[model samples]
Target chain A: MREAALSLFSRHGYAAVSMRQIAKEVGVQAGALYNYTPDKQTLLFELMRSHMDDLLSARAATGDSGQDAMARLEAFTRFHIHFHSQRPDEVFIAYMELRNLTPENFEVIEGLRRQYENGLEDILSAGQSDGVFAVSDTKIAAMAVIAMLTGVNTWFQEGGRLSLEEVEQIYWDMVRKSVAANP
Target chain B: MREAALSLFSRHGYAAVSMRQIAKEVGVQAGALYNYTPDKQTLLFELMRSHMDDLLSARAATGDSGQDAMARLEAFTRFHIHFHSQRPDEVFIAYMELRNLTPENFEVIEGLRRQYENGLEDILSAGQSDGVFAVSDTKIAAMAVIAMLTGVNTWFQEGGRLSLEEVEQIYWDMVRKSVAANP
Candidate 1:
């Protein structure tokens, strides 16, 4: 049901989607949605929060292991691209509908986002320190990587000419080269 | 008046903003706004279309001057970052409020966007032909660069730690390294 709401919210702007519309899509009474979320804002917030948490935890579970910084960065890039491809609607809603979040909810999601970004920044910093990666600015480089990966969700389609795995590999290659130590 | 409307649209969002509210922001009667835009959709379309046109023209007027593909790419990157920084409101509205555009207007803006993307793609193709770039996929690489450059609008502030020039330099360096033939 929340998934249905997410799709609707993503396709139609958050402000334009109503409780009744979500309920209709879910084949339930509008009041029933209140049992899950207090209001539209809460629903939107929970959806984004849960999506981001899943993203973070998924990466965490992958573990840094014995991989080098560049390898770890590549792993993260592939995971990000794959995860977003699998849940394009949710990812789109999380990014494009973020403005609709209330102040309290917005802060929660934004913090999660910052943590995720910090993960990449940490990798870039480590790589730079280890002389495995070279970048002009770790902060901007991290943001650039995140932005580039997120863009795949905007245009990627299932069963497209480039499979998800292929796209991931290509992006990882680009990212690795972008911050390569000797570059 | 359009500036006020653009601000509200960027902050509050397109669907959430109304003609009366825009008129109030401009200190004019709601009916007076009709003289400029027939409706909210038209207003949104015009704002985005004009901004994209200005961006394209700005790049075109920057002069070719026998600059190599890499040099042209750098100039384009710097111009993009600076332009987006100066008109953050329009950039925000152009991206986030795109859904509010009518189908006809949407296609117009989308075409312009494709043209801009293709412009970058063309540069990449030329660079590859000149043995200056080593991109595995020109289309995806173009998208990545555009996404990264446009993302500056999301986080850049006039008085931020990094000056516009510094930001451009870092990003340009990243892009060059990302696609350099010998990196």
Candidate 2:
């Protein structure tokens, strides 16, 4: 049911998708769907929450804390690109459907998002302290780096001019230089 | 009517907004809207096309060609952040409503977008030739730089921690370093 809702919401924006439509996609009655999800709003919130949860858990599993700041930053860059690229639908909805989320739900999702961002900011802050990175603001740098990496999904295709590995390297190079104390 | 449609589309995704709602927002009958746009699809395409045209024309008006590559890049960076910051509705719709556009309309809008991106790519290429920037791939670099700059819209606010000017400067610094031959 979640898969059906996600695919529908991704193809059509959240506001445009209906519970009945999701039910049809899942081969269930609309009434039966309500048992699983109280309403469309809850469904949307669940999808977004799960996405963030998955992201945070995956990030935690990277064991990046054991590495130094520079290594952790590189791991973050590559991991972000790889993780987000594989889930274009979720990424799209996570961004495009933010406005559709109720104010309370929005706050929850934003909190989760900030937690993930703080992971990167910690790396930047550590690097800054160690004199390895020269970022003006670690918070802003975290946002900037995520934005640049997430952008890979906008135009990247598997068989495009560059492989994901090559693209990651190119971006890793730019990202490394963007914060390096001495490039 | 265009204003009403843009607002409605921005608040509710294009597929969810009805012509009737747009007409109501404009204080007109639903039938009256057809006189301006034959259908919602046309209205969406017009909104997107007009945004791209406005962006490209504004970019052209900057007249960055006379400047050196480094100066042109700065101009482009500051210009993009400023122009996009002023038009959140258009920027949001331009990025989010892309999936709703018909293929033909998508191609047209995409062409205009590419023209704008190509302008930045030209600057990056120029910098590469002049040995001022050490970017690996100018096209990817252009995309990366653009993604980083446009990201200002995601978190920037009027009374936030930094003024837009300060934010622009910070981003310019990152951008300049990201591509600079020596940082």
Candidate 3:
């Protein structure tokens, strides 16, 4: 049911999708949806929050321990690629429909986003301190890397010539070289 | 008039912005908007298409001729960043409201997008042939570079910590190193 709502919200913008359409997609009366979500705004907030939580928890469980900064960054890159590909609709909704979130909800999601971004920044800072990375601006570099990785969701299609793993390797290689200490 | 529409569309989305609201924003009767556009779909299409056309023409006039591949790439990057920053609403509408375009109109914009992507690919290919660039996948690299440039539309603000020129320089540095022939 949430999947149906996500697809509808992602395909059409969140404001254009209604509880009636979501109910129709789920083959239930619109009134029944109220049992799950109080209103359209609530639904949007829940979907976005859930998706961010999933991303954060997944990254935490991936365990960056014992890996060099480069290795950890590569792992994070691959994980982001894999997770987004698996749930493209949710990822798209999370990104494109963010403005639909209420101010309170927006801040919650934004905080989670900052935390996720800070994880990458932490790695970059660690790499710089350890003489493994050379970047003029860690903040900008982190943003750039996240932008490059999240972009996979915009263009990636399953069953294309390159598998998700192959795409991850290619991106990881580009990212590593882009900020490498020697490069 | 168009500025009001663009801001509303950017915030509420193209589909949700009614002709009545647009007319109100423009301080005209609802029926008066029909004198300008046949329908909401046409308004959205024109907003996106004209912006893309402007981008293409601006890039073409930037006079990247006689420059090496790296120099040309840098010039293109700077132009893209500057143009996108100046007209973020148009850029946002072009990306987010694309699905609202009729099939025929969508094809026209898609063709323009392909041309833009091909420009990057062409530069990468030239650099590779001349032994000045190394990339594992020209197609993916082209998409990645465009994505990175287009991302400015999402987060960039006029009075943000980084100036437009500074942001472009940082991105250019990353992009050049990402596809540089040698580390």
Which tens-of-lDDT digit does each residue in B12-41 have in candidate 3?
998888999999999999999989889888
Clashing pairs in 1: none
Highest TM-score scorer: 2
lDDT of each: 0.84, 0.93, 0.86
lDDT of 2 by residue, B1-183 (tens): 999999999998899999989999999999988888899999999999999999998998989877899999999999999999999999999998899899999999999999989999999999899999999899999999999988888889999889999999999999999999987
TM-score of 2: 0.99
lDDT of 3 by residue, A21-136 (tens): 99999999999999998898888888888898999999999999888988888888888788888987787777778878888989999999899989999999989998989888
In model 2, what lDDT does residue B93 have?
92
How would you encode candidate 2's per-residue C-alpha lDDT over A1-183 as one tens digit per residue?
999989999888998999999999999889999888899999999999999999999998998877788899899999999999999999999999999988999999999999999999999999999999998899999999999999999999999889999999999999999998997
Off by over 4 Å in 3: none
Flag the better candidate by TM-score, 1 or 3.
3
> Which candidate do you rate higher for DockQ, 2 or 3?
2
Worst ten in a row by lDDT for model 2 chain A: A61-70
Q: What's the CA RMSD of model 2 in angstroms?
A: 0.8
Clashes of 1: 0
Clashing pairs in 3: none
- The deviation in Å at residue A167 for candidate 3 is 1.6
Query: Candidate 1: how close is chain B to the reference, as a TM-score?
Result: 0.95
